[model samples]
Target: MNTHKKQGFWHRFFFSLDHKDIGFQYMLTIFVMVAIGGFFAYVFRMHLAFPDMKVPLFGLVTNKDYNMLITNHGLIMMMWLALGMLLAVAGNFLIPIMIGTDDMAFPKLNKISYWFFLISVILMIASFFMPKGGLGGGWTLYPPLSTGDFGYNTPYKGFADRFFTANTFVLLAIVFEFTSLLMGGINFFVTTLNKRAKGMSLFKMPVVVWMINIASVLFMFSVGPLVAGTFMLLLDINVGTGFYDAYRGGDPLLWEHLFWFFGHPEVYVILLPPLGILAEIISNNSRKPLFGYKFIIKMTLLAGILSMMVWAHHQFVAGINPKAATVFSILTIIISLPFAGIILAYIATLWYGKIRFTLPMKWALGAITLFTLLGGFTGLHLGASVFDIYAHDTSFVVAHFHYTLFPTVIFGTYAAMYFWFNKFTGRHLNKTLGNIHFWLTFIFFNGFAFPLFLLGLAGQHRRIADYRQFEFLMQDPLPLYRHIATISAVILILTQFIFIFNFFWSLKKGKRVESNNPWDSNTLEWQTSSPPPHGNFETYPVVHHGPYEYNMPGKDKDFTPQNEA
Candidate 1:
């Protein structure tokens, strides 16, 4: 950005309040969190596979540390990596550029949000080092364990010791992370709604713009209950209030209700951006107009509506009303329909078109197949109360969760990064290294995640540091599968360094982009200079077409830029 002029070290190193710098900053920071989370997954998975052997870099895994590792791993991936990247990073990067604006509606608030996120990161990491080695109460932080159960189970016992502990940092970090998300959501809303370039109507906006904004609205509505509930939880632990403490006459199920209410919708908050990214990648590579553009938008809105109503399905066994459980069960199953429709529309977009199997497209296909298809089908089993009774809290739930989130969060993120890498760096990543990274990641990701379904069916439960105690769980396929999964995870983590190497190496020495629109895609971001400039477009752009206008009969080039007449 304005590289022609010389700049000081501090100026070059720090972001200068540009949306691009902020977005990229969010992305890089999230990747660091992801690396740490991945390492945690490796440590725990290694322990699970071979309980006798000590983990490398970390010593023996006790029950407490196992719980802490898994719990913080969940928090780190969900809060820091997924939410940060999807809502804040993608919204900041895509909304302004795609809608043909120079910057976010409120830039200062945007900067503040990143600072809050960084603070949350610090608090989260610091939580582990605090007393009792972080809250092992799981990511949900459910009551009893959340109430006083975990406190009592610790090394410090009896009323003589302090009732409250180090896990407070975890909750505190979450408070800040959520607060940051809310601020970023406000910025996305204002920028997209008010700051569009001329002719860029609501309908004319790209699918990603629609998806990110809709995700923001869904989060805004659903997280309010959790936000208020989280404050109550903090009070329960710190001040000895009995908000969720069942032992203290507080209803533990209330915590579940508040959590899943936001928790279920939170899934979509992360899912939609990737789906939108996939839409852009799929359409551009296929050289076809997006199929069912308006229909996709309508279905997404319907899905958001249904997402709020189905939160109770997670509480079917929590002993809510039978009729109420039935309603949520039916609604849970129904919510799948909108996403199914959206995915089918994407598949239809690929039909009878010139398909290019670019690295991004391969990753997109992996996401649709893994997240939308396999993930969707398995989720149905959990939707029904009868099935969930058997599957919930078991390895199946973990598998299904990974199947859904890993593809979108991990696979989908890779796809988007590769697709937009040129725009971000103004240089091409080595296709050779990228191909190796893609195949290894795609194959190994499934290698690890797929076996958990069988383990769940075999009656294996979650969060057990050592499964050797249970003779039935020690059966042939079980241990064998564990080994398979652990080995795969190791390979998967190692493969990412290839991408890391390629990422930084390409920034300086990789082939320079010969043209602005290297991919010949129609989106406005591609129409600008590579990496754009401080204010983005040199002149104000007037949108003349929808984002995906490829393969026009009259044009010499198949693509039509949105700003073109």
Candidate 2:
């Protein structure tokens, strides 16, 4: 369909269908969104640290601004930052390489997906500049709050009118995004299922490819309900449909059902790729085979299947049928088991192996440890109906998600970036700066999130600017939490400089990576050149063994490329 001919550097560099170009574009977009969304976080944290405080450069960020910032932050980070980069960038970049393919099955389709992704992302970012400001209805955009008024009496017009219009744009952007992702998911799923190199079997593929394939299948099916729900919500708001209108006997709970159906699985879809990166990095750096590799694969599939039945857990407080809530609660706890198996598998992989503390390895190891601890503990809290009652919608809930996902997603992304910087830019990142980046991020990340758990335990609800009304936190929410969180946030923001320095400084001046297999990686990706040319492989590589086959007997070194063995 792309009858366009490739011209010169810019087209080949930025808009080309080469997997590497697409991958870098994905990473570049995510970085841009992070800068924008992260600024909102910085200001949001400033507000938390000093309630109703006047900020420099932007003046006072009122509660309404706070709400809009947080909502947009979640949408941007989750969709644009995490999903956009991991699935679109990493998935598109790595899948063809891992499978030993020259390029995506349909290069033109792949390029279109990236372009549409860019357009959708632009529209999403543009939402903040809307006439009435962006949608302030939380990331979930649950009705009433999302469909009702803006809740604050600003100079803005009626809440319903603004909510309807702002949210319409949001839905439209999401629809475009969904279209792109759906095509991408279908392509990836089919490519993995059918297009392995001459000898690569299902098991011979890299764990990252497996993770992406699973996520693709999950996204393919899971996105439909939300796409449908968005249309219904739009119709209800504009066309006077009763889809979400209680007056027309349509229950708002229906919206919750449809959203969470997509919502719960979307987390795993975002997570699985990074987890795959962790699996690869941890195994390679440790110089050991990934322990329970088969188990991890099985668990990934199980988690995908179990995600569907557990959607109603979000509705526990929404007055879903008590029996349904109970079922969902039980299912939610059970679903954590497969995830537990995954954590144990990661931990087990690290036991008694050669531990290299390289930047990428450090991030991989740190993510596994922190993510497991936070994921396990918070899951325990959320699993029980009794605690869920207290923790629901509280800062505890926020802290749990931040701890569990923040490290995994953000750290995993950095790990992927560091791991592939050579492949992306043909140069290595500065290790010294990278280590500093890691430590500061690790410390401040917890600092920013931990107090939230303590505050939430003391009954601080989420989505509010003023927690001073709660006397329990009155003794010193500012000192114990707000100030500390703000300081941590500032430190966190500064820590990224080490990365910016390393990323750009090294892009031009860093040591050149001579060997394609820098880490002695076992996957087929290592078989290609550093930043492989227009077609991935100079010549088609025939994969000969399973991925992660490190330390096999008679191997020249500790690892052998799947394409070589």
Which model scores highest in lDDT? 1
- Runs off by more than 4 Å, candidate 1: 1-9, 12-15, 147-164
Candidate 2 similarity to native, TM-score: 0.94
Tens digits of per-residue lDDT for model 1, 1-565: 3443544556543645778878977887888888889889988998888896889998888888898889889989998988998998888878898898889999889988888988998888887776556778888888767543443224434332333355567778889999999999999999999999999999999999999999999999999999888888876666666787556677889999999999999999999999999999999999999999999999999999989888988877778998887788899999999999999999999999899999999999999999876798999989998899778878899999999999998888889888888897799988999999999998998899888888889988886777777999988889998889889988998999999999989988988889998788998899888887877888879998998889988999989999999
Q: How much lDDT does each candidate structure score? A: 0.86, 0.81
Q: Give the Cα RMSD of candidate 2.
A: 3.2
lDDT (10s digit) by residue, model 2, range 189-246: 8778777798998887778889988988998889999999989877655555667766
Alpha carbon deviation, residue 7, candidate 1 (Å): 4.5
Candidate 1 lDDT trough over 10 residues, lowest sum: 152-161
